[model samples]
Target chain A: MKPIIEITDLYFSYDNKNLAINNLNLIIYEKEWVAILGHNGSGKSTLAKLLIGLLEPLRGTIKVNDKILSQETVYDIRRETGIVFQNPDNQFVGSTVADDIAFGMENQQISREEMKKRIDKYIKKVRMEAYLQHEPHLLSGGQKQRVAIAGALAMDTKVLVFDEATSMLDPQGREDINTLIQELKNDGDKTIISITHDIKEAMLADRVVVMKEGTVVATGKPTEILKDETLMKDCGLDVPLTVKLSQELKKYNIINDIYVNQEDLVKSLWEYSLIK
Target chain B: MGIQFDKVNYLYARGTSQEKAALIDIDLNIDLNDFIAIIGHTGSGKSTLIQHMNAILQPTSGVVKILDKTIIGGRKNRDINIVRKRVGLVFQFPEYQLFEETVEKDIMFGPLNFGVTKEESAIKAREALKWVGLDQDLLQRSPLNLSGGQMRRVAIAGILAMEPDVLVLDEPIAGLDPQGQKEMMEMFYNLHVNQQKTIILVTHDMNYVAQYANRIIVLNEGRIGFDGNTWDLFANYELIKKYHLDLPDITKLIIDIENKLGIELDHKINTVENLAQALVQALGGANHVR
Candidate 1:
């Protein structure tokens, strides 16, 4: 399968003194939910910006969908990609939820009728249909992020980047967005890249890329990466609670398998207990 | 004495078409040296409740007594700065409030505002910087030039420099990386421990509430849903769910294990280590494991 997005030898710096992304190389395939996990200054967000042409790489190249990203092709690249940032208030440009969802479509000069159709479709996708007329300020942080996701989807972008989009939300809100992401992934075809420090969120992804100091430290399946305690610690991340509990129980010879979810872990424990 | 709120009711744009009640019949008593965690859904009056601690927002129909000062509703309180100085609030995303050119100047601003001497305020700023774990060299640099985490530390230090007896934090660790969040929580934990200061934290993370706070308060739709000890808060899962709150992961795991296995397990496990031990014991102890 062709890689949906290919980044090679990517180097970027905010100032000449510090390289925000240093000699990073990454490949994301079609319909893959890739989670980029790292600490605050680990260049994960910088990679997101570089992917959408918000920040230009000092060296190397980024290719999206077989086309090399350049100054001339940047707008086209952005049209194919949409990003939701950390703060919901900063990204909201419209007064109402419907207006916000329609803002991106209006920018593309989409017709009013077409815009209405996309807005209705995507707003329902994020489960914010009841809040179609609600203003941005009145909505909860999670609802605002849902509206932001709707706005992104209304653009019909194939590749969506969520840059710590759930960081500011409450636990319930985080769960809501995560469930929405799962639904989107189940629908398939779109490439999703989430840049976050949330271990549980990363555990749901198809691939987890751990970063450190602007470089890729490890990239593997979520289960594989999360099991490497030394690596997770080096990258300044906490292992998921279920994984940690499983490991601890394994030390006492109670549960042999490393489980990432609660139900499976409990089932394994029950089986072990019955055997004893 | 710390702070008390009696029948507090706060209305946004009161007596107008847009009037909305933010807090309804809030009666809370926060004792000195208390570590209290407030849990609620977004727009559940957490922010509005904490603002009353430092007189940032006065109640529409209540009496707020901070230390010895009494602020009555429907009356202008001219001496509220005394209450503000006694309760230092670290607002959410406080880094955005950093406006001073240098980090040191910004830290000193709060103490200086409260009538501390220039030299004393500088001393307090240095002490505050140390408390937040920032290096002394960064004091001269522009606060805007610092990293996001560092800027947050500086903002927190600005509040600490005020030497308030009570610290009210509104989601201070929001938007921080995992390591940053841990470090910030630890810093506050130390402050609560060593300084013996009252900590009133409004947060959405149940894990932090279970681990740190001795007392937990839940709010729902501008009303106090539940207020009790951390242990009771976790055990009251039904009430927790009703208020749109969740049990911490460790507690949830234990509950799940019990439900799946059709066996009763203790739900008092607050930490991962405790949960691991409890699971092993529930499976008939370590010796029984083949």
Candidate 2:
């Protein structure tokens, strides 16, 4: 399949400051869940903004759906690429959930009936039907996040970007969003690029891209990238809990490889015990 | 000599139609130099409960003691300056609170307002910047010029410059990258370890709380549901699950080991490296055998 999103040597910097993203290159396959990981100020957000033309790159190009991303195509890019930001309060423009979902469809010039249909579809999709009439301020952080997801998913964009979307959520809320993201990936042919500080969340992605000092340092399966002790330390991170547990269980020689999921880790431990 | 909450109850939008209890009959004591981690599910009133620590919201029907002064010292008895100075509450996304032109000026604002001399404030600002791992050169630049993580550090540095006795942070690493999250935690750990400053952090990372915190306080439904040592919190998996809390995946892994292999781990495992080392030890020093 042709790559859904392609970045060719993209370079971006603040209008009045130094380069934030430098010589970034990647090709995101359609329907792939890719996570972008980096240290603070490493240009992950800039790269996300660059991909969707939220911030114009100082150089190079971004192509989504095989269309070049430029000023002329910025609106179409936005129309195709949806971004859910970190803070729920900032992304929302409407006072109520119903109005918030309606805002996007309204901007897209979607018909009222079609808008309601789409709104109902996504609100149900995110499981926030009851909160459709609640004020944004009245909702908790996780509720607001679900509403944000509803707003983003309502647009039916081909590419979904989570800009640290689950960072504010409590563990349970984070799990809720994580499950939702996996469901969305399983249920559709959309591309998901989540920029996050959560290593566990990154491990759930199909591929992990590590960024350092405004550059792409490594890209591979999350297990390969995360299990590297040198890399994890250099990136100022610890291995994911599941991986750590497997490594810990190795004391009893119960598990061999470092897997990032509890089910797999447990199954491996049981098998190791039988062999022992 | 630190902070105390005695039968404290807090309500949001108090006396209004939207009034709802945010915190219910809470009696807790956090002593000087205590590093406490506050954990809870969403809508559990964790945020609102922390806001009361510094008089951001006084108790609606109870008493909050901070640095020997009660927030509800009465309508005519308000010690705003002392309350604000003694407890530095770093709100979620402190970067948004940055309005000063330069990073150094922003860091100096709290200290200067607290009546520190110009030279002393600058020294404090520099020290705070170093603690957060931000370069001294960046102090001359606008806070808006810094990166997301850098801006976050600058905001934190501003709070640290105040040199408060108690530091409370609400989801400090909520929007950071994994590396940034680690750095922020290390900085916070150092703040408590080296400086002996009382730290109360509100975070959702169960694994992080397990590894770093001395005490874990779980809030549920605007009330203190669980409070104990971090190990005990995880040791009682039933209680953790009852309160909608999760253990570090590693701890769960250990539990799985006991269930499936009929062998229980004798030692607590929190870090991957420590677990890996312990595993090798349990496997009879497998230096010669892979």
Docking level for model 1: medium
Please provide, for model 1 over B1-290, each residue's C-alpha lDDT reduced to its tens digit, 9 standing for 90 to 100.
77899999999998899999999999999899989999887878899899988888988999999899998988998878888777999999999999999999999998888889999999999999999999999989999999899999999999999988999999999999989999999999999999887999988777888889999988899999988898887887688668767788888887778887777767767777887787666667774425
Which segments of model 1 are wrong by more than 4 Å? B287-289
Candidate 2 displacement at residue A94 in angstroms: 2.0
Model 2, position B216: C-alpha lDDT score: 89
Task: Rate residue B160 of model 2 by lDDT.
Answer: 88
Cα deviation at B74, candidate 2, in Å, is 5.8
Residue pairs with backbone overlap in model 2: A197-B177, A197-B178, A251-B279
True contacts kept of each: 0.73, 0.69
B232-267 per-residue lDDT for model 2 (tens digits): 888886887799787776677667656775665643
Candidate 2 per-residue lDDT, tens place, A166-249, comes to: 887767678889999999988967889999867878878999998877788889998789877778777666676666556655
Candidate with top DockQ is: 1
